[model samples]
Target: MFFLPLVPINSTTTLGRQSQYPNSWDVVRHFGIRLSDCFVVTQFSADPRPTTASDALPAPRLIALDWGTTSCRAYLLGPDGLVIETRSNGKGILQLSADPATKDAEFAAELTRLCGDWIHEAPHLPLLACGMIGSNQGWAEAGYAPLPSRIMAKGPALTPVETRQGILHIAPGLVKDAGADDHGLPDVIRGEETQLRGILSGKESPASSIIVLPGTHTKWVLLDEDEVLDFTTSMTGELYSLLIHHSILGRHSIPPRHPDEAAFLRGVDVGIGTESQEEGRPGLLTALFSARSLAMTNDLTADAVQDYVSGLLIGSEVAGFTRRWVGRTSTQEPPRPSITICANPSLASRYKRAFLRLGIRVNTAADDTTAKGLWHTAVLSGLLAKEKA
Candidate 1:
């Protein structure tokens, strides 16, 4: 139902004895944050709380907080979702003490530092939060809502934690019941609730849609109107990154630039091709050989080689999903689900072009589609009431 892709950034290099977020590792972390397989960190901000008690000045309606693994993102949204101001802090859930002894205190302190002033402005104003802050490792595990239930469903709500500053609501990640399906399906997602909700909010009456959220573990979410129907995951992005940058494939090719359409599409072509291999399909090895082989054997250009590499990754992803779709058990005609690609514009644009070129129609959702969807779901389901500005 609700689709949220969780992609963890792998940090193989250990931080030296610097007692600090090491610069070299930090670059990796920054790259990991940007190229994170799980979630995306778009912008960061810090804004002072309103202090004037004048009746003419009203406090912000609700604060949309996306407290993730590596960062805390807070948005002071107006009644219409227009951001009045935003704030962020380096204190993410991972940084919180998992030891349990100091977790609560540290979590509270981080929240206070980031939002205490804002709470003073509107002590009674409601707050909505989503992401890992509510996961098993978070301050509190906000239990999941079941299939066909929208993100804002009343089935399982956020676990509220009260502090001297104000009340904090932590969004729960969706987790399927054990043995829900074969392979002991243990599907769970943290930060994607808002994104899925944002997608539903765009429509007057949500249709039966299948959203493809491409990343480390690509999520294929099936939605029936506002309700989440079912879902599955694919390790597309993570595999590509690992094979190209770290694994054996790295021996051959150069690093790729961000927004490299040529490389991305090239990956799609090779990966999605029917004849990849039955034996482990050493995608990286094949891609490496393709590049080196091209250089050694013929007079191919660097750009062409890059394109070939990209095709290998994307091609694999497409091919895998195609198998899942076609091999799915059903006597009925294939689900007439619209493919909505929810991701960054650049990625979405590339996917749009690629899918189109392959005769697949995909509608690209807005950039902030996830956050907005979460807010709208909350409002529609009365998990959050519409603000009166």
Candidate 2:
């Protein structure tokens, strides 16, 4: 049996209004590709034709998209899954109209506004998407794929949504059942599985590895080769946002002009109990108040308070995860698995620092995994015709 958490998108949720039509030149410049290059085509005939210089260049094959809660990213993938061009906007699911009467229309309009040109130029190419766009509150619910499954397998079906442009195929999220064991809690993952598929396609390692995706709800996935053995999620990022915006801890915080590394590391030490003088050190609950008290006492600057609190939350999350998953005994400790962080550079750097402080070295995966994952999935699922040698 498979189940997914259906968190409805609040109609009042506001991520700020985005322009209905984005500037095309700006998009081309941002993605570093020519506007004309995106629409190039090579006509074929029954008569034998010699390959031209243009024919040697990779041609667009798939229109891949990663549509999440707060943003949407579209990619034009060429032969062998190379990205030819890309576009992004703030028109996520949360930005759509809350009225059920017009929600579907809004989504369709957003999709066309985002990449209607690509769809128009490459009508022969297939469209594939992965992310919250497949959620219950999204344009359509793609459902969930059961656990103990191969990440690249094509058994589970992709949900198809009809639109003015074409039929968009949405990949299903993954769901794990609660077993009668230590790691029995049920969990669900949307979009990250495609990123995992992208990561595994590039590198092959015999030993197991941990893939950490940092965001509002961070996912710490356990990957054993091509299969995901188990995983866990932490709401550290969301908690930090709430504390900095809604809680008393953020009352005095003024955004720092520059990041305070010293203050952040200090908070990390406190949260991890490394700064504790006594054997019975106070835990995270007690440590959290220090953010407010230290600011009031002038021991910590108003500017540095936010970073300090961020480090504290992240440190506590990392410490808790290691304790639960990486076992330690009196005699000896088990070998830690290799960790690969898949995130933006800033977040990845922060996580790398946290892991390094604990003497664990980790690698950051490429930024194009989502696009590559979508292309790979489309190819594996028989959406694309086999390329001629």
Candidate 3:
């Protein structure tokens, strides 16, 4: 059993920016509710840590890892762009043995068992890992390089662990402080960065663009070419979960057969156009009670509660983005650079339609693209020193 007490990474927080403390603690507490002793992992990198290796051809030249909070996924990319073999284990930074005296040995053994069988054929596989597994409180805090700057995918400061079979390099995560124009947004991500970098690299003419990554904490990133211009975080998903499951709104919800309900659309319409739709503007709490009132008055049905909730969520998202995106758009500004939603199938489909109605293009980036992106970041970082040599 592992315990992660959602410690506030930034306690002396600034004003005007969203609070990361309450939100993070809320998630940690919610996660612990199901099982107090269960081990958990997290994955939320907006870029991959690139490393540049100085070594010549060794064995495996390509290695990649996407380590999240709840789970970790990895791939060993062959020189031919195909996965030669894959390895994974229940062990992640958050779940690794807490007893530091033996944690490394335990982690190495578990990791080796997951990859050792193939290491003999590819003894020197360079590895790269993204996500929460590399945070300061994580396995080892992978340092951040800052915005308007990007880490080159090459071998970085690689740490070798002697597993039962041999050695392995554990990839690190990035951390950064807020700078000018960033409005002091103290946030960090792990695995998603590699995916974003990969997505941008594959483009025919990659330049400055806004990247929308939908997840528990949706990240809106500003990229100036390869450099990450800046970014901001939103807790819409967590807020949605809280309102529907724990708040009074939960009473009216009947578990929609479809997550995106028409009721949701109506809610969005009311919330977004509230200034023009109603005589007096209402707060979110007031709006929430209205849903239940509507249901009781036969103004809405049980099935309609789902959409009503959806409307709250979508409306909130639209409002947030509207504020963030208003003065940032232009007919020549790359057409909003298709929203990249990293979420499950149901919500993904729903968000696609929601965004489409707003005249936005949407598409799902295949899972393979994420893996390839991490692999690309590793090669850029110096992680493959032994393999590349």
Candidate 4:
């Protein structure tokens, strides 16, 4: 429903970097895909005019939104892209009205409810959004962009919704090579792409790197020269949740939080296939059972099992990805990448530990990368110069 028929047009495009095109119609014609088809979307709007010298000047503040599956988050960003203030609507796409017809209206209403006061205060500030808010199931079906391409070269899929405040620009999600996936889970990322953009904005080299963004569904991205070379996804956090609380293996006491660093590292070792000595090492499913086995049998403490299990899952994700990408040995030997971890402090620490365990050097990205990323995309697309829609 969000495709919009690739019709002929004279209006502006939401796609950010492909500035040569006179309109979104021309932009799509040049690229052969809708911005949404190329990426995904939440929504946003621009002034529909070219950015001027003044528009290019550093802005005092802007709105950076990370609207995902579990929640809607807004950040009031300073000109340098640091967070000035934050607002959260503990609701995500899943929390919207179920009926399709009313969903669009709710998207507007919910965002207004979440950031209405801020919008009222700063009437013309551009609003940039990423994540599920742009999916087919979300406000608009801003298509998907294929991988091995410039992540921000093209702006976002412009899905603008009208409201009393202004237009909400839904960003696009990127889809991996359609031909590569035979079993059908073509790699795709919505919000992470924006976060990666934010990360690159701060770095000197546009050269490629192994950047990992950890979350409910963690993303491992290979960015090259401002392009998204490729990526993969793992349901690390979700798996931890299901295994530790929903499955039989999790049918034990779980404290709210615990230290248990030793047990966690041990779990990481197991996940990396180093902790086990048995000739026939157990698989993850079988290894998961040990959380309960050890707890019930007094091998793992009740307080430590949860963190240990978490370590195992995260460690496995990191190790598996490393083996596939970082460990590949070719005759020419590709240059070793500088692995950067972008996540909240806790998750970043876990991932950094995992990489270090295998001797991989890493750097942690600032926690505000997502917010800054929103800013970068907005500037690239000339959104800040525009008036409220």
Candidate 5:
């Protein structure tokens, strides 16, 4: 029931770049259909005002939400799933009251506060949400869809939570059982599945590709066309934060005025070693000490130390994944799969740099993919039917 509204407005704000309209226009052209119908609104507001009928925008067809642990983003989509406007706030699930008696009420209040005006104006619009909002800790438990599942295949019904406004459909997360290929441990993904669907929507997905989502816990998802073959998670970001703030490697570190790309690449080079070096040199465990050692020797600046350590961790993760999953040997190179990074611009840039250093070319998904994924899921789940207009 919690509806949101979007309207086109003029703004020079682009998602990540300084250019105006070029990137947004490119997305419209890429979709091929509904060029005239599409409205690209990249500007988001922390506190969005209500829209009146006088504005005369296209009617919103759906209200999509990407609600996570630490933040929640809501989007209003017009015909063809064009992003109308977006509202976000820091009231993530973690901010909700801990008392079970008040938790549901808290969630309802938060949703209403986020998009109450839209709900009042468009009471019947379908509402769809993804991410931790459907987890055990979220508003309701939308269980995991089993592994080796089709990304767009229908039929694992969405969990519905009745809110003050209406029923909100929640997408289930994906789960993989412990198996020979999964490092003998099970894995789960909640929010990233929606992002993956968004990345592949309206495109002829490659036969096989590696989708990397960089975050606190980075995910390396392997997809074969529409199906999710397998995935692995790496805690590279979390570890980096821990080391830089709490560990010895970061003891002398200070924030760099600018990024030290050279230092970062040097760390990457060490992590992705030559065959001879790989055979004789120690692994990440031993190399981690070099951050402090190099600093002590005055060979590395305190400001650059953090970037160097970041590169080392990310490079190690890439090297490990490639070796184990790709089955590359010390002497023979394996055929590389197409890699795409779906993340915010900053995080994506870092991962892209790391992969390029390892001789891997990668594609970056659009920044608005989460919203697109939510819309796609809503359509596929029958929450929003395709419109002819």
Candidate 6:
């Protein structure tokens, strides 16, 4: 169910002029060792492998955990605020018992198994977690902090639990402006606030910017100074998965060893309405039908259909955003605020290319903003102090 890249996971990629390792390998082989040695990256840190622990290395005092729907990443941050080490497992909040009777003990047992070293070595270190792990189903009901909010604000409703290891603070998720979303209630975000905090750290802040985190549910957020203004969500990756696996296009959506740029770009243009016509090109859904029909007519190859549909979805996300938010198409060429995408390099590149096709420029932030955000917000929340010892 993961949104994996179209290329062979082991194959190298040549984007424009620069060549790069396979995306999976790039994340796995950092610090020149197996991912097991350093844990998973989730595209949050450039290299998960910690620098050699010299005699002067400060002792770790904080544990930053990015506990998502399917995985839990534990980061041990030294007093210098750098990652001392990381570990990950598949025991996300979804795997926990929702029943009050056993959930607490179950979570404690899971935490101990996953972070036994840290519990034993740094029992005093405070633990902070962001993502679904803070949701109602998680160990604690760390509720959402309402919007018009500071990204660094303390979880106004933290669910703190005292354990033998230390007190663990569950970072609260965010609730958008009431009725701002089509849902009539409000749109919500869990872990991205942390990543945004991390990406903006140390950089000269922009007065306003568009911050995008692309994945299963891509988040397009507006940053007005240091406060989060508003955001929209698009299920591009999730929809892609559904269509490719369950639709008629699924038969031809087999991934390739290497992608066909022509096919992908063609799909993007179609989705963005660049090559759309008045009669048959009704909308994205109708346009998508072309993938199957064109393939049946021998106009498109089966191998390229997947890339084409993918391009359509990604490009559609960009085009839809511009039209809905900016009120213009790439043809009219309205000035767009600089776009900053915080995501894996490969995923970011896809969005970058889609934007470039629309004559918009994109800036990329580090992939590991979740790690950064958690630490920054923790410091702001007074759970973690800023002083570097």
- Which candidate comes out best when scored by lDDT? 5
lDDT of candidate 2 over 1-389, digit per residue (tens): 11111112122211111212235335544665633353212342466355444433345688889999989998877777766567776388888847778989999999899888777766778999999999988999999887676786553478999988899999998888886653568888999988888887756754677788888999988767667787777888998999999999998799989888988888887776733335888878889999999988999999999989888877777666666555421124333777788998988887777766666667998666887788778877778749411
Of models 5 and 6, which has the larger lDDT?
5
lDDT tens readout by residue for model 6, 225-314? 667878878899999889889989977667778978888888888888833335655588778888999899999888899889989888
Question: lDDT of all the models against the reference?
Answer: 0.59, 0.74, 0.55, 0.69, 0.77, 0.71
Residues 23-130, model 3: lDDT tens digits: 442453455432223222222346623322211111235556666665666565645234533545546666765687876676666556555544544455555567
Per-residue error (Å), model 2, residue 285: 2.6
- In model 4, which runs have C-alpha deviations exceeding 4 angstroms? 1-61, 78-82, 152-154, 178-184, 274-279, 328-335, 385-389
After superposition, the stretches of candidate 3 with alpha carbons farther than 4 Å from their true spots are: 1-61, 85-92, 97-102, 151-176, 179-184, 270-280, 283-292, 296-300, 303-307, 326-345, 362-364, 384-389
Per-residue lDDT, model 5, residue 330, is 38
Weakest lDDT window of 10 consecutive positions for candidate 3: 7-16
lDDT of 3: 0.55
Clash totals, every prediction: 26, 0, 55, 26, 1, 4
**Candidate 6 segments exceeding 4 Å error:** 1-55, 98-101, 153-157, 178-185, 274-281, 331-336, 386-389
Model 1 regions more than 4 Å off: 1-58, 88-90, 152-156, 178-182, 256-261, 274-310, 326-335, 377-389
Error of 4 at 163 (Å): 2.6
Instruction: Estimate the TM-score of every prediction.
Output: 0.71, 0.82, 0.68, 0.77, 0.83, 0.80
Candidate 6 accuracy as lDDT: 0.71
Q: Ranking by TM-score, best first?
A: 5, 2, 6, 4, 1, 3
How much is the lDDT of residue 255 in candidate 6?
78
Q: How well does candidate 1 score on lDDT at residue 255?
A: 49
**Per-residue lDDT tens digits of candidate 1, residues 74-118?**
765545554534565548888886789998899888877877655
Judge candidate 4 at residue 160 and give its lDDT.
68
Candidate 5 worst ten-residue window by lDDT: 10-19
Q: Which is the leading candidate under TM-score?
A: 5
lDDT of 1: 0.59
Superposed on all Cα atoms, model 1 deviates from the true structure by an RMSD in Å of 12.7
- By TM-score, the better pick of 4 and 5 is 5
Q: List the residue pairs that clash in candidate 5.
A: 1-166
